[model samples]
Target: MQSFLSKIKDFNNKHRKIAPFIIWIEIILIFLASIMKNICRHYKILLAVVVVLIVIGISARHLASVESKTPEEGSVVAASEEMSVVEEALQEATVEASNEASGEESLINVDSAVSETSMENVDSAVSETSLENADAAASLESTASLYVDSGISEFIKAHTEAVGWIKFEDDLISYPIMQAEDNSKYAIEDADGNDSETGAIFLDYRSSADFSDSNTIIYGHNMRDRSMFGALKNYKEDLGFLDDHKYFQIITPEGSGRYMLFAFMDVPKNSYIYDVCGDNTSRMREFLDTIEYKTYIDTGIEPTVDDKIITLSTCTQKDDLFFVMFAVKVDD
Candidate 1:
């Protein structure tokens, strides 16, 4: 009996980090059962206690049966020292796991804050008509290659009238920006940059876009390595994100145009603020108004009425949905 007690004590001392967590879990289970039974008179706390005890018994039996314990014949002091090393390793692992969890939680919190701020800005900026017009904008399917490059910038295929791709930074880029809205081909890349590696989905769901304006909504995963649009999420907290990536060079097959960042706001999932009127003037005016209202910080390049626009959208760990940053086409 004394030997058994010493063995149990040694096990506890060896796995101190795991021991406390298991004990706390047991306590929590027991406490929750107790509270539920007390709140419901028909549910007996005694029965809950019995159930918990049965669970504990089964767990102990399983552990005893599954774990192999080879008794080491060594000096008692040496055994104790080995046990201490094991305990230290377990504790260090536990601490590292805890720190990782804390960091994830912080990222989630930051995402939530950014989402909330985005919605607030959108709500403050959008007109009631803007919300309603999003549906109307969806009614029209934009015809391709109508844009005649006014000699500002153009990427035409060799000896062909139709232009759907371009060469940028010495890389041949193409467009019609191949995207699979919601199906098997779930991948996107800059046809212009020829980097299918971008792994971004450029979306155009004008059930939110209210205007004749092309809503080139793009999306990318926020990878930890800053791969895809991982670096874009950095815009949530600082200028390091903003300064490094502000302008987007959109190289469609017919033309390559740049867009300057005009607005950075996170709209809610169902926010119909993307709609603009059929009347071109009204549509442009609406864009001007919303951009002016939601422009938290600028990307420095001023967007005028003539430039087409691009919208980059992504989900954050903090929110259950997404946030978007808006920019307009530029000639350079």
Candidate 2:
């Protein structure tokens, strides 16, 4: 005990700057020791006091750690809500002060720096959210373009003029339709805009791309290899083919359309059926009448001016002759 007291005295004298704190701790230790010695006979009471002091110290440290932690990013909105709660607390405090002081008003001060920082954080969050939304929308559009029908997607990627696709339900004909400033480009060029004898099927330059016109014309070559519109000749050879294979699907970027075969016959290159795509209602009536008069076999389906018609045209062996098939928008 004497040697320990000598060491403590030496430490206090060596570090004079912290000597007062050391002396205070020493005094507290002595006081506790005196109490412990006096209460040594009551062992249960002494143990309970020590445990209580340890618990209080641990709780104080835990509370300080919680209070010292900084808020995370995106927590500004939550912090703003907490600020509202703080304002409510201050209002309550003011009310209590008034009640205690017989209606005397109490001034409450809020830091301007804290309010400005919160506003800036809110603005930053909104800007970041908007940028994220824009990036997501761009990604969705790119993904959708990637997911287009593989054949059509390749055609468009290779040739910008490629417009849509035509498919018969019975698998008679399937081809990509191209459009240009004029109809003759596709008549000699393939879907990839390369020069080929078996040229691509193409839409009329004068008609609306969405097929909203009263009459729309799509032309393809009747190849001997049975590609392109070569299978269309099957309907003419056996009129019975129309009984089951009447519907053809036209798929565009906008949507798809199912058309039922209503007429098929040979027409001149300058036929009036080609002129019905415009806004002239009288011409459309004449066109329908001509179709009824000139169709090869009566399918019992007569289309009116209110309905839309799509015409598939191909060249015959003769120079001036063209085989044509007329289908009305049956699905509409």
Candidate 3:
């Protein structure tokens, strides 16, 4: 303890020539510099302290001689020393006041410097989230495009444990439970099902890969009140909606694919919508043409029988009344 105190004494004597204002300025400047580094969470408090210190320093200084000599000596000698001390103090204070206050003004602290960066971050987060959703949607749309294969059943069962099913007449579309996607099998019945829009007979239908052909169809209600397929109606027009809802992905253990939106329109239900018989080739060709001509907005993708198509059918209540959207598979 004695040694430490002696060291401090010696240090103080060595620094005695330093002006008091200068010493305080250096210490505060060092503190401010540290706060500046982590200012993201404490900028306001540090900035306030720095401002207060500056104001106090400015008002508290007393003009006095560096050393007082005998009054008997020439008075000019005392005046000169005082003038020198004042100049030295002022110069030292200025240096300590601005220590570490330089460099980049910080991107978040200044709107002019960092607004674009923040916007970019928001855009990136939204874009990433959108990408995740798009990937899920793309997977869904891809499934719609496929002709279900046997291997796909295992894939579906393994990945999509959470499944929701709906029956509108003879059609059903199964999906995961949560807002995004899941692999579990859940229940979704039609308004006319066991519970009249609820499900007393929620059944888990295995993938048609075992018995159904590559092409399968599912239909649901497009209630005017916007329950099942109501959200799909917006695709019938051009809007930023496409920006949010483009492409679909249908994933199964067998395969996963990216799908592009190709058709949007109302069609007659009894138009023999599900006839994939001997006339399938010509029928498919005709179907493709009709959908191409009917798309609300062209997504720039052409359809071929080589490409499996997934048709999302819903009720429209119009003359033809089948609200349908077609999507074709792209990547697996």
Q: Which candidate is the best by TM-score?
A: 2
- Order of models, best TM-score first: 2, 1, 3
Question: Clash number for every model?
Answer: 19, 0, 26
RMSD of 2: 28.2
Q: Highest lDDT, which number?
A: 2
**Model 1 compared with the native: what TM-score?**
0.40
Candidate 1 lDDT over 3-63, as tens digits, reads 9999999998999889779989999999999988776875576779889999999999888
For residue 289, model 1's alpha carbon misses the true position, in angstroms, by 2.2
Order the numbered candidates by lDDT, best leading.
2, 1, 3
**What is the Å distance of residue 147 in model 3 from its true position?**
23
Q: All candidates' TM-scores? A: 0.40, 0.53, 0.38
Model 3, C-alpha of 58: deviation from truth (Å): 90
Please give me the total number of clashing residue pairs in predicted model 1: 19
lDDT per residue for candidate 2 within 201-319, as digits (tens), equals 78989878778888898987765334667678788777898999999888776678899998999987777777766454568888888889999989889998889989898865444
